[model samples]
Target: MAEGRRVKRYADLIKRVVSEVIEFKLNDPNKGMVTLTRVKVSPDLRIATIYYTVLGDEKQRAKTKEVLNRSRSFIRSEIKPFITSRWLPELRFFYDETMDYAERIDSLLKSIKNDADSEEE
Candidate 1:
């Protein structure tokens, strides 16, 4: 329970810090309104997986990923002050497809509904 709490706390901190870094600190215009969707921390707090989404297509997302990865060290350094660990955790940025998947499912459901209505008519 304690470990869970610790992990949650750290994950929240990492997410907030990284979000700010990406939004305000990074000078890359190619980031394209990147939004941090979630953050997960290892049990020992040595690794943080940051999930994010871009406000564009696959190419923009790919560029965002590349930009973030390139700026990982800078982001980590910026957030180092907020981390209480003896060593900063390894930051890994990943594209979160949850929103995209949800959108796809929604579109499919709407299509199905339309088909059913037409068939009934």
Candidate 2:
């Protein structure tokens, strides 16, 4: 229970700090409206995987991913002051696909509704 709480605390801190860094500190225009979806911290407190979504197509997403991955050290350094841990966890960025899944589901539902309406007509 205590370990869980500690991990949660670290995750939340990492999320907030990383979001701020990406939003204000990183000046790369290629990153394209990057939104950090969530942060997952390893139980051993060694790695923090951050899931993010970009507000563009595949090319833009790829660019953003590349930029983020290249900026890992910078991001980690930015989080250093806020982190209470002795060492910062390894930062890993991954594109979150939840938004795409939700969009597909919504489209299917709308199609089903349209079909039902057409049948009724």
Candidate 3:
């Protein structure tokens, strides 16, 4: 649907804004080395799911999430002026664990490959 495309476009726009504009521009200590992973917007573009990853342990990740949540209002206000949409999508933060899962799978495959090579030898 055309609406879905618009929503996706908005999601990408938000991702770019958060990464290039907010992350780089804002000097927030509590952000904690956060990386914007992905964004998913609803069909109506009223709600957005922003996936992020933080480079640290669980506690640090939690802290970063809290910091981001606290700054949500400010971020919304700051981005509103730039966006031309009638309704700014509500931002929701989620931790992206895909990288960790991929890493584990890669390591397992490497170990299996090493075993195969050893058997061949």
Compare candidates 1 and 3 on TM-score and give the better one: 1
Residue 21 in candidate 3 has what lDDT?
54
Mind giving the per-residue lDDT tens digits that candidate 2 earns over 22-62?
Answer: 99999998989999999999998889999999998999999
Give, for candidate 1, the lowest lDDT window spanning 10 residues: 16-25
TM-score of each: 0.97, 0.95, 0.84
Q: Sort all candidates by TM-score, best to worst.
A: 1, 2, 3
Task: Please give me the total number of clashing residue pairs in predicted model 2.
Answer: 0
Give the Cα-based TM-score of candidate 3 against the true structure: 0.84
For residues 1-121, could you state the per-residue lDDT of candidate 3 as single tens digits?
Answer: 8777877788888998877655766668877888898999887678879999999999998888888888888888777876887888788999999998999999999999999999999
In candidate 3, which residue pairs get closer than 3 Å at backbone N, Cα or C atoms, i.e. clash? none
Against the true structure, whose TM-score is highest?
1
What lDDT tens digits, residue by residue, belong to model 1 across residues 28-93? 988898989999999989999999988988899889989999999999899999999877999999
**lDDT at 8 for candidate 3?**
76
Superposed Cα deviation of residue 55, candidate 3 (Å): 2.5
